[model samples]
Target: MNDTSTTPEAGAAGSVRPTLAAVARLAGVSNSTASLAFSGTGPVSDATRERVLSAAKELNYAGPDPRARSLRRGRSGIVGVVMEERVGDAFRDPIKIALLDGISDEIAVIDAGLLILTDAGEAAQRIEDAPMDAVVLIGCSPRLDESVAMLRQRGIPLVAIEGDPADDVLTIAQDNREATRVAAQHLADLGHTDVSVVTLSLTRDRARGPLTDERLAAGSSNTTLERLSGVRDVFPDAGGYVTRGSFVEEGRIAGHALLDDPDDRPTAIIAQSDLLAAGVIRAAEEVGLAVPADLSVVGFDGVRVDGLWPYDLTTLVQPAIDKGRAAGVAIVEMLEGGVAHPATFTSVFHLGNTTAAPRAH
Candidate 1:
């Protein structure tokens, strides 16, 4: 048998990959001219471009190396999207999908790619070492302040979507407190005093149980704390269940725990997310309780839930996509040596059939 893979001039790979310099030499042009021909960023004659392309094809060269171009530009052409949860968990929410769509739309203008990083799980290492020109923190928690500090020290432009306000970070904030307050007040006006809440994970531990004073104090998520505060503002001492994530299953568990109590049951339940509200409605049905009549359910984030029809969930319609766009624009401005002012957006109240006055007992 004859072993055939090695060449005298080539390393173990059989044939050394051609470089731009080799292509330039073969094309009889300067390295810079060859680069400009391929990049189209500078003035290059049609004849020069053709020569470079021919040379590249002959040597099986794939134009300029992205690593070298990134080195020359001193940028990775990557924008990091930092999430507090796993990427899979984030993608499960419709609101997050819309937000990502908006972010992608704006970043495409600059020919930048997104790098999704999570503070938890295996993706956590990337949060500290990834080469990103800028980073957008979505639903950041206080525990990640160290990560933010490190990113700031590295001079990476930072933007936050509903994150805790920092000194230099540009934030795209939402009216979580005000929106929930309005939703709660709507329930208040419906002649229902016994109202409960199904909250998003208050802390990173994600302990699923009733909300206690210690748990409330230990809550790290800014959005959850703000929304919970809003609910308390209306129904002081109104207790509720804390969920593990923003999933419908968590909502169903909470709904069962809250509604199954024979001694005391809330006439209305305020879910932190629309999906949670839908789950709460499902749980209501499982217990033979009709929505709006036996129980009124209200949700935040105007997301369309499948199988949630005929119950146009009463919710605070938030501009999730606009918020993402604002964050992307802020990132671009910061990268270009411009200041991006912190922006706060309000949610509109959408009256839906999911909520109604509690039935007379």
Candidate 2:
């Protein structure tokens, strides 16, 4: 407010850098006195404090770094996100991106950074070693046991989204089995007597091959298993092809493998991801088939698509982003010693443009 006291150099640099001495000199006091005025850790008249702040403004100075205050408070002020996928890929997916955004909002109250810990394309072993005040597992990663063990051992707070066996870990859960079962029943109701599935992979090995019962029994990803169980609940004999990840390419590959042989093909297909469903749709086109008319397609994770063809995906619209944000809140609460337990989230069924009755032909 004091134009006469203000110097033009304050705006010259990109950022204002006012020293304690500068604030003190302007306030007509010693540097220590100015420091005391700013910190309030030492006694200072209210009027003196106001004067020092005014001098800081005349020099266009921002108050002391919050980082310094946080450091002195003995808080690491960091929340770690442990995802098995690449950061770029994770951000690209709308579901994961939304979740991260939500988590950021929750962590803001604590003034914490969301540190992303990727195994650098490694496995669960590396997940444990990340420097974090707490850990949130983003999606269904392959190394749950090792990852969980490490986090628990270090006494780092932990939360998982769609993790296995419904353990005591803080989790945002989904009705994966029940949700997929709804989708499967929809297909069966459509008179899809012979239906098959395109499933997300069960292991980190990520092999592109037909799914075997043995592997299914030992499957690690809880989401994958629950979805598979849902399918089996309807068409007990339904066949499926499992791939390494929940990407479009994997769905396309699984789609081609499942749909290429017309004589043996099922009239309906359930892909566990929107990307995979898109891929499966692509595979159908390459074989000269019409969506819903020749083949009915359904996918999970009600996501949006721009360049996808033929139809909007029929799917279960799970709140992926909300799940991530909830995990962040849980972690922060646990770290702050406020909350004492984990969280579980659920998904809803969303019917879109992708499913139809099997052609009587």
Candidate 3:
């Protein structure tokens, strides 16, 4: 049962010998038998294994050491994921969850593990020392540079998902700008010149409210700026409200502000993400406005939101899961000493019920 009565020996100066050896000694078996008793790697008689385990509990041994195993393999078996936002915040979004699920699916086939590293204070420091064979940057944000530099210095293989096409690192890209352009052109074709835009956060601060012109112009995130440019391609004069996070609440806030004043309200609205489009939809509904009837809205990212309100959201669906899987595959390839070409993907336009011809005032 419990080996609380066993005494531990001084292993090597500061370190103490674990209870494994003691368990073997007490059980009157060889040290290798004791190891097998704990590791379950080899056959051990029922009576012999039970005694070894009993001695372990008395000695307070937590079990086989992870550090020792990692050192032996020269690998941590952990894939570091560097995200632009806080770790908790990143996981909170369904988009991030789905992408991570895809990554997990791939890594599971290889028996690897995922480790999340946020671009925060001490956690940033850990990036340099943490044992990881490879790393994947979730998005291209200015905040990622320092971490990327650390990973590179360690000679770690790096893969960036939905990030810039950098020289040293492998990239998995989406047609963010081009896809947005396609979305914008759809509205333009519908004769909606009075179109306005609701955009995602341009910086890590991600202030959860309306975005000012200065912030929009100064955004450090590549995707935000690129998507905004896509909108401008069709409506050069169309102005917009920037949102801090891509959450539905942020979209709702932006939508309310853009649609509040009838005199200034645009005939159409373009949201950078599907969640934002849904928020714009909610805002319109709150004001007793009709979709495509009173106000038209179009969104990007064709991610199927379960139980959508009405007309399917007119948006561009990018392969977010594929983007993640590509990054994981590239990291594994690089770690295995193989060269992998960067992956670039384009988005497809889905004309849903949320967008249509602008209503005559």
Q: Write the per-residue lDDT of candidate 3 for residues 44-130, one digit (tens) a residue.
A: 578887887776665555455446648876666567777767765664466776666556555533334566776678877877887
Candidate 3 — which residues are off by over 4 angstroms? 1-69, 208-211
Q: TM-score for every candidate vs. truth?
A: 0.81, 0.76, 0.79
Candidate 2, RMSD to the unseen true structure: 12.1
Error of 2 at 312 (Å): 1.9
Please give the RMSD to the true structure for each candidate, in Å. 12.9, 12.1, 12.0
| Model 2 TM-score (2 dp) | 0.76
lDDT of 2 by residue, 93-130 (tens): 66766676667656655545556666555544556765
lDDT of each: 0.82, 0.73, 0.73
Best by lDDT: 1
lDDT by residue for model 1 (1-361), tens: 7433222212334367555555566788754456556755334689999998998777676653447648877777677888877666886888876776567556644545567787887677778888888899998887788888888899898899996747667889999999999999999998889999999998877788998898988889899989988999999988999999889989999999999876789999999999899899999999989988999999999887889978889999999999988988888888777778778999999999988888887
Q: After superposing candidate 1 on the true structure, give the runs of residues whose Cα lies further than 4 Å from its correct spot.
A: 1-68
Point to the candidate with the largest TM-score.
1
